[model samples]
Target: MARAGAVNYLFGTRFYKMAYVEFGNPAAPAVVCVHGLTRNGRDFDALAEALSDRFHVICPDLPGRGKSDWLQDGLAYQPPTYVVALAHLLAQLNKPVSWVGTSLGGICGMMIAAAQNTPIKKLVLNDIGPYIPSASLQRIRDYMLEAPERFGSMADLTQHLREVHAPFGLLSDAEWAHLARFSARQVLDPTGSGKRIAMHYDPKIIDPMRAAVPLDVDMWPVWEMIHAPRLVIRGAESDLLLCETYERMLKEGAEGYVVADAGHAPALMDYESQARIKAFLLEG
Candidate 1:
């Protein structure tokens, strides 16, 4: 296992604590792995550990998720705010960084890399593409809305993760347990009865999705603006990354990998998936 540490800092003027886990040597080249919506930084543990030998890995729990501070105003969860927060993180690194992002995290990567003079040197966008249909997006939002914020027991939380994230494919019992452990927090059960567990993220992290009228936005312009070397990962069964758009992205000169037996997103925890990402990032 690679050496690791937890670090936190105050970003913006809100004093919201931005937390992250760092792996490998600080002197090595950097790689930043950002997680999907409703998921936190720990999602990258396996991937980070795998890459730590060659790269310094940083996995940040975007505000309102995991160990990071939650925002009082849900509206602050928008992409612009997230982009600003990322800029702050990159500045702190004081060096160019490679990025690995899943789902919402991928979208965040696109916005940052599309900007003028971005610090992102290379990028891996997992299970997302330049565009997704409105209906597919609505389905994602609906599922999130249905998820219970608090669980009565570890069993309840693990069961819920299994159902919704079944697309992660066949993970070992230990893998599932790892997710359940890091994905939740023990909190006062509100009923004043002992304690219950709640999902680690702020429920309002989905506010932006809920508030918007669903529309199929054209993201090719965003895709085109990115000049860094890039790779796009698509789940074989993903509804969010349309086959047509993904193909177009590849034809547009970006490299792509399709993960088998997965949908919506690839967790990047499996060895094969990690190998694909590793090869892309390490290529000369």
Candidate 2:
């Protein structure tokens, strides 16, 4: 059976929605898994399956992505907005929650978890941390700042993924097809040309003071505020999460691990990555 679910909630005067997948008993210890930029809750499917029996896992699609409703104003697609929405979601659950966030989601978790007396009991940052490299951020923005482009067929989409997400490494043709279908949603135009989802987020979400210049934001204060037990996973070849950041985490006494043959992020499907995360989350 499909383990997915969704709930609607309001932010400010605007109404929005988010989708989640639930697993295990409601009364059990809870874990929240969030997806990276341009991805949805569905990205956690494999990892959720592995943890479902042991914990109450809920993976939510963030606003402007996946099944979540797009804001009438795309400028609202910032980390602070997501943190507020998630605070409401956790209040709905009415329990202390732990978090495992990939990429953008991880950044949100860090901000929330660092707050004094925050509800997040433990944190697992998958392929993200404070002090994101400018080069990696620019690469992500380059893709997000563009309007959804159409492809002739699944093969065309796969080629796009290969060039853009080469860090994800080689997948079989079938795997590429599976990802392409989920990442795209049909547009309502008369001709029915398909469009990439998350089309609602404004391309200028992060406008530089001048065009073509990189934007930089420092997050060391937030990183230092983390109080709960934390685990950070970095893919060995990742452009986003660097070795230096991982080493600094180790120096700060946070648990750290690296995955092989992966870049930017490693899907929890990797055996070593799963074991490292599972062990951290299960620790008493």
Candidate 3:
């Protein structure tokens, strides 16, 4: 195992905290892994552990979704908010960083990298891009829009996770348990709220984004602006990243990988997915 630590830093007047977990020597070149919407830093645990030997890995729980503090307003959960937070994070790190971002995280990467100057030196966009389908966006909003309610036990939460994240596909009970544990934080009482607190994220974050979808905002100009090496990974069954979009990416000279048995996103947990990501990140 690589040496690791948790570092928290402020983002704005709001005092958002990002939990940074390192998996290798501090001196090693760094790769930062950002999780999807509704996910936290722990989502990268397995992947970071696997790469610890060769790279210093930093995984941050985006505000409102993990150990990080939730925004006072859910509307603050938008991409512009995240992009600013990321810029702050980069300034603190004080170095060029490689990025591995899934879904929402990937979009943040796209926006940042498309700019005239970006902190990222290389990027791995996992199951996301300029174009996202309305069906998938609607599916995600439907789940995110739900209000939190009491569940009798962890078992109930686990079942809910499985049902809502059915796109993640069948996993063992143990896997579901792991997902449940990291997803919800105690909200009940001092001894700990047996009642789960849905990590505070405003579902309204996706509203302005709705107009940008169906065919997706013309992020193509930004795609052309990125100078860093880039690799895009799409789940073969992903509804969000279309085959046509992937082809457009290829025409733009971007490299890509397709993962089987995944949808919307690839966790990079499976060996094949891991191999693809590792190779891309390690590329000269």
Q: Which is the leading candidate under lDDT?
A: 1
The TM-score of candidate 3 is 0.87
Ordered by lDDT, highest first, the candidates read 1, 2, 3
Residue 58, candidate 2: alpha-carbon lDDT: 91
Q: Judge candidate 3 at residue 55 and give its lDDT.
A: 81
Cα lDDT tens digits for candidate 3, 1-284: 53434445455565666655668765777888888887776777778877777788888777666666566665567778777767777777778788999998888888888776677989999888777767777777667657355555677777887777766644667767777787765566444556655443334445544445433445677777888888999888888888999888878877999887777777677667777778887889
Query: What are the per-residue Cα lDDT tens digits for candidate 1 across 20-138?
Result: 88898889999999888888888899999999989999998888888777887897897677776777788889899999999889999999999898989999999887897898788
Q: Clash pairs of candidate 2? A: 238-264
Alpha-carbon local distance difference test for all models? 0.85, 0.75, 0.74
For model 1, the superposed segments whose C-alpha errors exceed 4 Å read 1-13, 192-195
Q: Please state the error at residue 135 of candidate 3 in Å.
A: 2.5
TM per candidate: 0.94, 0.88, 0.87
Clashing pairs in 1: none
Best by TM-score: 1
Give lDDT: candidate 3, residue 122: 92
Clashes of 2: 1
| Tens digits of per-residue lDDT for model 2, 223-242 | 99998999998888988877
How many residue pairs in model 1 have overlapping backbones? 0
